[model samples]
Target: MQEFISYKNIQIAFTAEGKGKTIVLLHGFLESSSIWKHLTLELKKTHRVVTIDLLGHGNTEKLGYIHSMETMAEVVHAVLFHLKIKKFSLIGHSMGGYVALAFAEKFPQQLEKLILLNSSPVADSEERKQNRDRAKRLVKQNKKAFISMAIKNLFTDENRNALRPKINTLVEEATQIPEENIIAAIEGLKNRKDRTKVLQQYKGEKVIISGKNDPVVPFQEIKEIAEQAHSNFIAFEDGHMSYLENREELGEKLITLFS
Candidate 1:
């Protein structure tokens, strides 16, 4: 069942389903809790799956002008706290991973497993920061165009045509996000901290799942980071949106890890 809680005077949306140990799934930028419909359907069969629509996305209300990753993490922490959930595994995709890292840093003792999907621990590069600035401007000027261009670039060229239908659906959903919310997320991502040491220092079970052809997070860079952190590395032969391109493989990998 869907539920809401007040945080910073806003209603934060989330859902808890099934029964057993808990696993919380966080979605990427321009995505809501709805993005995990497929994964939740499968994971809920074995584990109590919880998915939260982070601030400024999905059914949740935006907190403010600049929603930093740290601030977003606090929102997640508050929601889980209200649910009386102490320790649980966390899986974050893309921007969600950035929030996960921030959460892990503040509440290291509260996590059982930390999985970063198509996410990195490093801060935004100089070029990336500049791109974010451009994106923010584009969002302000033409939200629909920005959403369309952004979603298409997430998939690989080889699979773009085949995945056009899925891409269209995503674009439609992303287009609903408020202009300010989109910019808030871009601001957060651009200013997120470098949590490489945080991941490396984490003592609990941790893994990095990446796409070999991920245009967002470079595959080789993530693999090397995983190695340096002594964390397990799982690779898919697809792009950033592996949940759509390699759905079965992702489900199996998640099941095996959380089993």
Candidate 2:
């Protein structure tokens, strides 16, 4: 069911369904909880599924001009706390993964598992930070152009034409996001700290799922992260948007991991 919780005087939107060991899904930057619709339909059958629109995304309101990963994690905690959910397996995609790591650091006892999909625990490298600055400027100048290029770049060249409709849909949804929110998110991601230690110290079930051809987070780095963090690794044969490019495989893998 759809619900909202007041966080810092703003409504934080979320959806919860089914009834079992709770599982919380967090989407990447430029994405909201709605991105998990396809997986939620299946995962809810055996697990209580909850997807929250992180601060500045989906139905949630922006907290401020700088929506840090730590703040986003707090918002997730508020939603679950309001719902009386004590423990849950957390799955985060892209930017969501950064939030998950922050959550793990603050609420280790409450998390049963940490799964990073198409995301890395490493902080923004110098080049990436520069890229983010450029992106923010571009967003302020031509939001539509930035959104179009950003979404398209998520997929490989081979899948671009095949997934044009889906890509367009993503672009459409992202375009609705205000320029400030986009800039806020970019700032958060660019400043996010390296949480490799948190992942390595996490004693619960941990997994890192990545696409072999992911341009955002390199496949080799993720594989090494899995090893360093002692996380079970699952690799898909595609680019970043594995949920769309490797739907069936990802769904099955998630079920097995969450179970």
Candidate 3:
């Protein structure tokens, strides 16, 4: 069932399903918990799954101020605490993965396992930082235009054409995000610090799921991260949104990882 939980005076929307080990799914930036709907249905047959809309996304109430991943992590922690869930496995994608790492650093004891999908522990590179700054400026000037560009960047050219309707839906949704929230998210991302050390500090079961054709998080980068942390790495024959591109296979892999 889906419900709302109060945290930091904001109403966080979350959905819980199934009956076994608890697994929390966190979505990427500009996306909502709805992105995990299919995965959650498959997981529910054996595991209890919880998916949440991060602050400023989806149905969740957004605070006026911007928040870093650390603050976002605390919000997730609060939701888990309220549910009386002492420990759970966490699956995060992109921005969500960053938050998962930050959360693990702050409260490692509360996590059973950590899975990162198309994500990185390192901070934004100089180019990415400059890109974000450019995006922020564009958002101020033309929000809709910036969101459209984001959609193109998110999906591969082939996927964009094949799944035009679906891709457009996502882009439309993102375009609707409050301009203030967009600014806040961009600011938070730009200012984010490198958490590579956080990965080294974690000593639990860790899985790094990457997309073979992911233009955003590229295979080489994933390889470097896995090598550095000595974590398990899996590659999908797709792009950044591998979970969506290879749902059934990814779901099966997740079942095994949590088993």
Candidate 4:
């Protein structure tokens, strides 16, 4: 059922479905709980799946023009705390992965496992920071173009044509995000800290999934980060949108990871 919790005085939105050990899913930037439709439909058959719409996106209220990952993590904690959930595994996609890392750092006792999907624990490199700056400008200059290009680039050349419909839907959804919120999310990501140490010290399982041709999060770099964290790195033939483009295969692996 859909529910809400007042965190920082904003009604944070989330959903809990099915029953069994809990698996919390956090969506990437410009996405919301709806992005997990396919995965949840399958996984909820065996596990109680929880999906959250993090700050600045979806149905959740915007925290501000500068949402730190730390703050987002705490907001997540608030939602789970309200539900009285004691323990769960986390699966985070892109920006959501950043929040998961922060949560793991602050509340390791509640986390059973951590999965980074098309995301990294390292802070933005100089070039990426520059790109985030450019993205901020692009959003102000031409919102539609910015949203279109961002979603289109998440898919690789090999499958863009096949996934045009899905890309179009994402573009439409992203276009609705307040331009300021987009910039805030970008800044939040750009200023995030490197949390690989959390993985290195974690006693639980750590899994990292990356797209071979993802333009945003490079695969080679992700493999090295996973190594430093002592995580099991899984590579997808697709790009950053593997969660959508390769749902069947990724879902099977995620089931195993949660198990």
Candidate 5:
């Protein structure tokens, strides 16, 4: 059943399906637990899957203007704590990966496996931070237009045409996000620190999935993270949305990852 939990006086949404070892799925920026529909259908066949809508996104509510990664991580921890789910695997997409890293740092023993999907542990550089400022400005100026364009740009040139319908759905969801929450999440992401050391010192199995043409994350940096963390890494020729660009391949990799 879909449920809500009170975290820091704000409500966070999550749902659980299937049975056996739990696998938590966290969506990226402008995403909700709904993004896991396709992947969860396959994954739940072998494992219990839980999808969470992070603070300031989806059905969740914002605690304040600043939704820091650490605060988001605490929210995750609280939800799991309430569920009595002491141990489970965690997989995050894009911004979700930042939250996952924060979770790992706070509760190292809780994860059986940690996967970063189209995400990295490095903090934003000066250039990216400046870009984030621009994004926030764009959000304020024209939220709908900015979201539509951003979603379209997430895919590779070749996939863009074929994925038009899906892009519209994503844009619709993104547009539903309140202007304040959008700004909060962007600021939190920009302020997030370098967490590479967390990966380096992590004991559980770690995996990194990257998109070669990802506009936000660099493939080379992802490769370096994998090398440093001594983790398995997968790179696709697609862009930021590898999950959509290569569902079959990414699904297979996730199956192997959970097993």
Candidate 6:
């Protein structure tokens, strides 16, 4: 079932399924809670899976203002608190991973375990900072064109070519995002603080899942995060969206890790 909850003065949309150990799933940039539909269905058989559309994504309200990692973490906390869930495992991908780290820093006592999928703890590098600025400008100039460019960067060449239709659908959905939301997200990305220290500080049951061929968050970075956090690392054959591309395998890994 799906519901809306107030957080940071915005109404956030979330979907929950099944009934057992609670697990919260967070999506990456330009994606929504719908991205987890398949995985949620599979995991629901044994667990209560909750997937949320972060502020400014999907049906969630956009504040028309930029957000900080701290603010985003508070939003997640509010969602969980509203559900009366004191402790649960967290699964986050890409940008979602950054939020997860912030949450850990603020509310470590509430987390049972942390799973980062195709994500890293490092903040924006100089080049990435520049790219984010460029994206913000491009979005202001032409949102549709910018979204098309983003789609290319997300998928592998093979998927881009073979799954053009699917890719286009996602891009179209992204293009439909409110201009305020896109701008807010870009600003958030550009201003996000480095969390390497937080990663190093955390000493918990953690798992880092990476895609062997991901260009966004490379294998080396994943290795560094695992080593720094003293956490376990798992690799999938696919690229950035490994959880979606390798749902069954990824699902199995998650089930085992949280079992």
Off by more than 4 A, model 4: none
**Which of the two candidates, 1 or 4, achieves a greater TM-score against the reference?**
1
Ranking of predictions according to lDDT = 1, 2, 5, 4, 3, 6
Each prediction's total of clashing residue pairs, residues at least 3 apart in sequence or on different chains, is 0, 0, 0, 0, 0, 0
Q: TM-score for each prediction? A: 0.98, 0.99, 0.95, 0.97, 0.98, 0.95
lDDT of 2: 0.93
Give lDDT: candidate 2, residue 232: 93
lDDT of 1 by residue, 1-259 (tens): 6899999899999999998899999999999998899999999999999999999999999888888999999999998899899999999999999999999999999999999999999999999999999999999899999999998999989778998988998899989999999998999999998999999999999999999999999999999999999999999999998888889999999999978
TM-score of model 4 (CA atoms)? 0.97
Per-residue lDDT of candidate 5, residues 1-259 (tens digit): 5799887677889998899899999999898898899999999999989999998899999878878999989998988898899999999999999999999999989999999999999999999999999999999999999898878988988899988888889999889999999999999998999999998999998989999999889889789879989998899889998778988899998988777
Cα lDDT, model 5, residue 180: 97
Q: Which stretches in model 5 have alpha-carbon errors above 4 Å?
A: none
RMSD of each: 0.8, 0.8, 1.3, 1.2, 1.0, 1.5
**TM-score: the better of candidates 2 and 3:** 2
- Candidate 3: the clashing residue pairs are none
Q: Write the per-residue lDDT of candidate 3 for residues 1-259, one digit (tens) a residue.
A: 6799988687988988889889999988888888898888888898889898888888887766675888889889988888888889999999899889989999999888999998988898899989998988998999999888886677777777877787787888888788778877777777788888888779888889998888888689778888899889998888888776777889889888876
Off by over 4 Å in 3: none
Give candidate 3's error at residue 151 in angstroms: 2.0
What's the distance in Å from true for residue 87, model 5?
0.6
Q: For residues 1-259, write the lDDT of model 4, one tens digit per residue.
A: 5788888778789999989988999999888888899999988999888999888888888887798999999988888887788999999999999999999999999998899999988888898899999999999999889989888888888678997888888889988888888898988988999887876787788899998888878789889988887899899888898788788889999888766
